[model samples]
Target chain A: MSERRFPWEAVLAFIFGAALGLAYAWVLAPVQVIDSAPEALRAEFKDQYRAAIAASYAANGNLTRAQSRLALLNDADAYQSLSAQAQQLLAAGQTRESQQVAQLASALQGLAPTVAPSTPTVPIAATSTQAQDPNAAATSTPIETETPLPFYTATARPTHTLIPTPGKPFELGTQENVCDESIGEGLLQITVQLTSRRQLPGIELILSWSGGEEHFFTGLKPELGNGYADFNMTSGVFYTLRAAEGGAVVPALTAPVCPAANGGTFFGGIRIVLQRP
Target chain B: MKRWVWILPALVIGTALGLLYGWVVDPIEFTDLTPETLRADYRADYILMVAEAYQSEKDADLAARRLAIFGSDSPAEIAASALPFGRENGFSASEISALETLVAALRAWQPASGAAP
Candidate 1:
């Protein structure tokens, strides 16, 4: 009878072949990805994109485009995301970048584009001179009128500057305790507007309770109202809210107590309205 | 000897299958992409954004820093490349002007603290 032997050599060869195949697959020729959407960017790169958007918003005060650009990230809550990012930046000692982001957040919070008609897109293309940059003129591509992105028009529009470098100072117009159970965990809602009732954004405020002080801005939640901002409050904590450095001060503010649909009680909220005196 | 005859063919077949799977069946999906890989049109728009911000800030250094996110391109060259794309792609003339201004600033820019090598 012929002696049978294990095919160790053939097995070894197959193993070698598989190893070579995997190396070639994983390293030598990996696939190339291009034309990726902004949403697909890595976390750090997304933050970078957000920073540029914030800076552009600061430069032009075009909240609409800024919001649209931010929407590309598909953040669950753009305002909260921005505020959190600003806080992160501040913690990282990137003070100016933080402020830029915070300022944009505030202005965006206050704008009610749907109702205010504040940032209307008026084309500015006609204002441009025929002269182009020599370098750009030389290497121009074959021009095609492609409208880019969602809701973007081909023409450049004049910016409606919402937050002047230092906008008009505001004084407390009204501070009321809203004992409503529906506004979620009780809010310290603040509304800021011009004397003419135009919602004012970019107004800075400081909120302090016994052991902690936090600074926040208006227009961070424009859907609520442009020039509107709010913070959550704990049931028993007393707080003091002030605008700018020495502007109007509202003291001894706290979350109110309200009747719930069930036989239970819920925390209420504070509503503070600020306007130019 | 019979098994040995199949080893080279097996290796070749394995390599072909691996290449097909890697390049076609399941191409590597990127979860962490930098701005350098942005689509041509989107890249142009991002450059336009930098130009708009430059128009507002008028700080070439900041513009350069923002442009630096592209990883490889010089700020001026990056901004310059966008202008032609912007012009041909329906970016308003004023937007084109903004791109021009940014490119000029980047070209003339010198580091404030002498970090240039």
Candidate 2:
């Protein structure tokens, strides 16, 4: 009987040992997995942040400090301080801003065109001179009639100078490509011979007059480097053009105007002649 | 009685196998990311890219930046801006609308720093 009891006791001890071992494998083993989870997530979050920064810079050519903040998601303390300037700029409306902060917040993000307009098609077999200015004297003209009989009469069309319309703003640039939408004022009517796309930095155009309300046009903040704007000036004001970039203004062009300001800013940086009604 | 004792070992082995399966392969059910999530990612990328470009290249000139991003104004400039925009944002209708607004605003804005005519 005693021998029988010993075997039963041994069986009970074996069951208790197996239970303890199973508990360790089931509970303790998964704890390690749980421990590694946050780290893995943190790494993935970092990758997402970097990808965002790279995309933003590639699209806009500049990064708002706020964007940089988003990239540093792991460092919330640093993000708050660094993004202050960007927040202020947005508040001040200096930069074109978006309503959403993160893609996770909404489904409608990135619906805009990824590319700008396609290149315009130029006419085939067109000569440079003809293509540039067909009105030049060297271009072909209709033959003159010899019979003085008709007492030729020529109607003269008056050439009108461009002046800003009241309450309208003028910007610099020419026109929009067929595919891309035109931003800002498009001086499509005026022809500009574009020389350089770069800005003439440190120059400011000031409105000076002998007697009138003080007016000025300075400190250009470009949205996308497509075009810029200038104020319409009244006749008899001394107009001084200056370039300003990186926070300093430098003189670039100055003209004493006895005439009114030209059409709303011409795109592509060209001289434009406005028509009078 | 001794033969039945073997049952204990088998039960223990089975439990161990179950635990291994649960820890390694139990929770990995497949679920794809939705199209909506992808769309959100795309939008986030575009806005952030535009904002960055405006700040750096155009010196924060909204009009010029828009032109650079949208490629409006002369075909040549448009082409130039287009490559960048396409490579980054790809052609989309919403981008076109944003470009339109930018052009309108710039055209109407009389810069404090007068741009040469």
Candidate 3:
């Protein structure tokens, strides 16, 4: 008579081989694709493509073509995508890009006419405050001086009457999430731009969350961009972003989950973009 | 036959299944698609958008640089390639005109093909 032996060793070998093969196939030698449609792009890359399309529309002032390009993203609602991106770029502190996306979205909605709207007169109040704050502005202001010192403001220009427009609302244009562990918890990166896409330096950004409110100004890091400022956040707090200039309230901002560089995940950082929409 | 012989066959079968699962049934997704692989209609619209931008910016050198993303094709050739597509697909005369304008600039343009920035 013969006795049957269990095949436990063979079963163990099969499991080990399967794991090894899967690791090799999926991790070591995955397929390499050189081409893909913009519609099929990963989320972050799709954001970049939307920005380029917005920029191209800005340069061309062609609504039809802009719409056509937006279609390539295959968004169910191109306007919603543009509007969403406008906020994201703003929250990311990309003032120029945020304005471009906002303008493109506006144009698509027919609110911003594709016809180059005659340049709105610069808010005289906004201009004077920006011009006086910089030492380079001294050269622009042009007084008889032998040497201009860095960070020096010329005192002679009489302050102009604060126009009614300075009192105008800034209207929150966009707010976006940025999840990077490098940006410490509850960080808010803010940038403001004019309708013309020029960064609006010196305007104040006010943050009010739950029981507390704080304020800051752009141009704190002019090297970063004209309208740039940052704030550290505390965990578990909800925040609202507002303009000290009477308008533009972005409510309900909180940190979203973001992946860490070291294979961990954390939740923090909100970027808000504000402009005279 | 020895029990060890059965082990080798089982291991081989397991590996084959695993490789099939990873390579075919659940392959990694493609995320960063370059511009060259766009569908034909999308490609034409992109060129037309470039041409529209050219109309306003009037920067032939810049337009040439943008078209260069397609690789291995002269900017002029790329613009020209889109015209037939534009016409067949009911592109308006003005839209077609923008494409033509781009082609003209690209044709005469050079490293001193002499289109102004």
Candidate 4:
């Protein structure tokens, strides 16, 4: 019998090819993605930093805690960014939110003195200074009484102190009685009407339920005629609507039991009418 | 040993051929993608999606859980770090803005301990 020769040459060839191939693939011919650092990305980081500060403020309601959390970024850009956001909010007529954001921005500025303060359209610094002065009580009186709602009777309409514009105030006629009615199968549509049967416009209202509150301006839908708004409520859920600007509470309206209608609409709802007393 | 001398030639010839193929010929070009790079690309999108979900669902616990995929750090930290990484990786201005908005929303939504959802 002839002795079988070992195929060592083939084995060696295979190993050599594999090794070379792997080396070339891994070291020489491999594709690479060039990494880049963008200025916009830096801006984004700054934005996130501000957002984080705002969120911390919202959660803890502690300026110190939020400031401590902001210390991690160690970037002074937070001041400029947050100051800009506050300005934007103020321009949009969100006074309360703008003040809150401005406070956060001021906190960031305190943390980083190296950063120059950005100019705010609103008198943030002046307002803050006035707030801190013990003897400025007379000047601060208007701010303390700037409630969104004030009491009004049928014979006398409350002055609109919370109007965003300086000269234009809301012309609130009077409080009318709300009519309890159901429409569109089981859907509850709360229609705010005047004694003249015209739909009320530009009235801010708050709807409060078990665990949540929603604020909305009326007259959003022209077809709904300025006074029509709808809310989804569970049967037996008690909800209250209050005039955000006048502080008058609509009689507590409970979701009424309604026969099952098309599209799962709930019926037996109440209609609210605000009339002059 | 003499008969096996062919192995030397074979090895040299095969290695030369493989090197030629890999270097100048039809070489396999593998993309050098690391986990960090992948995360850099997807991080902004992920944060925005999480924020939208949080807005609709208002579930902070779930947002925290989903945001944990980036790391063990707080969602704010992860988002803060990701802003730079995402920008370096070519995230658009709108995308970055969206991410920023979401981070803020998430921070605002974080409930106190034992608070109701």
Candidate 5:
């Protein structure tokens, strides 16, 4: 055999080709695929965009910034869509939340005219006399009617006001007595009587015992008067009474002693007076 | 024939090296993902972030809208789906509980028919 010849060039070519292939396969190809793959759902992106707008609105209370962010959705009918959502929420009986959504929709609607029109200058009347003249008002009726009619109609619908209901204030010098008495042998009756004797329709009393609670609202028993309410307590059990409004506890009279069962009849009938604090 | 014999070994070695680099040494990670993936654990973290944002903003509608993107039919379902993932991912107990409360609020806001049973 002739002196052995080494194919160094072929070996080098093979190494180079292998490195290129590896780089292409490992680094380039997968990166391209990842870059092309859909990252998030359209709905998800919309939600995120809305969240960002809300956050910006909250941070600065800036309607302009919020509207600018909302415009990113590129939906010309975004306000209408929000309004529809609000209506749907209302139909679902989510009144509070529906009102909130409706407000956002209205805000977006308010921003539309300011954002869309390129003309920055407002039209000025030729003379102040035109604004004051009755003849001018009569002549401009058509234009005025055209523009303000929609504004009036839009404002006519009462926006739901989320005012917190105030707690009923007790009249000064008002006093009430809650008494428990034995009606007959082994029977007891509890009664509430007001010194002013004004029967407030909404005042409520809640009585809690060992494992139960009962509510006594005024006017539930018309005979009890507006401020008058009562509940019979089970003998041999301790109970606490509290005045309440819409589930909120208010200051009320507490029984001085827990009613006790006496072999045949109940004992410990006590009367306590509640005064306006 | 003898000169061409080197071709087979070179081809084999080159292919082996390429595969080694591609699969082991410099392999690409297709699984590396952005927040857009919305994976279970990622979604749990996102919901927590939204909740924190809501606490300061106090915007219920915005919160509900953000949550709806998860594609759950109801907030209860979303809570149910996220609770385990959140727990597994080491989310705080308070965060998990707040999510439950949020679910209840959202459920209350949902229509009776749309609410989770």
Candidate 6:
């Protein structure tokens, strides 16, 4: 009968252990889930983060490049007193210091719009609203009203010259619309009418440009009854334009009129206009 | 009777301790970013981090944003949508340049590609 007694000490110890375990399990574990978050969402965050950094660097690099150019322009005596090495750079023609100077200047000036909103002090929600809803800007008075750059509308008409003309690649051209002046200093609005000799079913035209660095704009849907696409630009910057199809770059069917080297059937033209902003 | 007195308590205690640790410590150890447990749990801080990075507009922001985005396994649609946020909230030239590098890095990473990595 004595041996058949309830094990009071053992029972108490068991209860104590169970309680402690439960406490640890319930209280401590949840914090981990709260910390790491979901993986898919994590990836999204990373991508945005990267893009932000790249943009910052590019903007700053352009700013520095501009300041350097300004310094050179200020020093005429420096140019006159150039060493043989400096003179060689000028003669090589490979380094267009003058053009570079102009580009850097324009880039720096253009950066104002991008830079103002980028300040860390500014609330992201505020800027985000402004972007998603242009009208949302009215709710809060902006730090400063932006002087909207006037945009000019231009018409581009394309005329197909010859297609499938054996080695001639397709060709097309449109008369330049010089009737209206471009708006803003050093601005160029190019409206091009594009067409193919034959209806290449399921074909789309892609236009890409390399300015300060490679920039691309795709999905140029054809215009009504006329295959047309328009691209905007600011002058004094180097641009490389290409016509692409089926995920490949090909020469333009029609000759480009502006930049001298774009004369061949597949070659496109480059234009640089000097205008006051 | 003597065996039952100690054996039963020890088993119960051991089980309880195991359960407690399993519920608490195991999850955290499994999910943290430590090399061994990298995949134990998914993380979503990349989004907030990127957003905050853009808000900063400092040159460092761009680089930070890029680094955050490139290392994750986010969806394409979400990635595409985030671009305008970056553009409108533009930062200094250096920051923007960093963003460019970040884009290039993510582009090159090309994670698994279907929808989400």
Could you list the iRMS of every candidate?
6.1, 18.6, 14.8, 16.0, 17.9, 12.1
Model 1: CA > 4 A from native = A1-19, A32-42, A60-64, A71-77, A90-100, A103-123, A126-160, A163-203, A206-277, B1-13, B72-74, B113-117
Query: Please, what are the lDDT tens digits per residue for candidate 3 over residues A1-277?
Result: 9678898889988997888778878999986554345676667656766766765666544455456456657788887777667656666776755766766775665444243311211111111111011121113221111221222122232321122342235766678788766667768888887566756544557889878888766665666676678888776777888866467778777777677778887877888777775
Ranking by TM-score: 1, 3, 5, 4, 6, 2
Best by lDDT: 1
> DockQ for all models, in order?
0.34, 0.07, 0.20, 0.10, 0.09, 0.10
Q: Which parts of model 4 have CA positions greater than 4 angstroms off?
A: A1-11, A15-277, B1-9, B12-39, B55-58, B85-94, B105-117
Task: Please say which candidate is ahead in TM-score: 2 or 4.
Answer: 4
Ten-residue stretch with the least lDDT total in model 5 chain A: A145-154
TM-score evaluated only on chain B, model 1? 0.73
Locate the minimum summed-lDDT window of 10 residues in model 6 chain A. A157-166
Candidates, ranked, lDDT: 1, 3, 4, 5, 6, 2
Off by over 4 Å in 2: A1-22, A31-110, A113-277, B27-117
Output per-candidate TM-scores for chain A, rounded to 2 decimals: 0.44, 0.21, 0.40, 0.33, 0.28, 0.20
Interface CA root-mean-square deviation for model 3: 14.8
Q: Rate the local accuracy (lDDT) of all candidates.
A: 0.68, 0.30, 0.64, 0.46, 0.44, 0.31
Query: Please, what are the lDDT tens digits per residue for candidate 2 over residues A1-277?
Result: 3354345544554555556555655665542321111112333333333333433333322223223324323334432222332233334543322211211111112211122111111112211110111121132210111111111111231211112222112234333222112422221122211233322111223333445333221113334221223453442334333211111122222222222135332222213311111
After aligning candidate 6 to the native by TM-score, how far in Å is the CA of A220 from where it should be? 10
Residues B1-117 of candidate 3 have per-residue lDDT tens digits of: 577888988898888888888888998876566667655555665677667567655667867766776777899999898999777755555557768888987888875755653
lDDT of 1 by residue, B3-117 (tens): 5776677677766666777777876777788888876766786787788777666678878888888877688999999977776656766678778878888888876652222
Which RMSD values do the candidates have, in order?
Answer: 11.2, 24.3, 20.9, 19.4, 23.3, 23.1
Local accuracy of candidate 4 as per-residue lDDT tens digits, B1-117: 565767777777677777776666855533323223322333443454444334333446655655665556777676666577555544434335545655665566555652222
Cα lDDT tens digits for candidate 2, B8-110: 7755665665565545545332222221222222323333334333322333344243333222353223323333443343333333333333334345444
User: Per-residue CA lDDT of candidate 6, range A22-107, in tens?
Assistant: 65666654334322322212332322222222232222232332232223212233222222222222234423222222222223
- Between which residue pairs do clashes occur in model 1? A109-A219, A109-A220, A109-A221, A109-A222, A110-A219, A110-A226, A110-A227, A143-B88
- TM-scores of all predicted structures: 0.55, 0.22, 0.45, 0.26, 0.31, 0.24
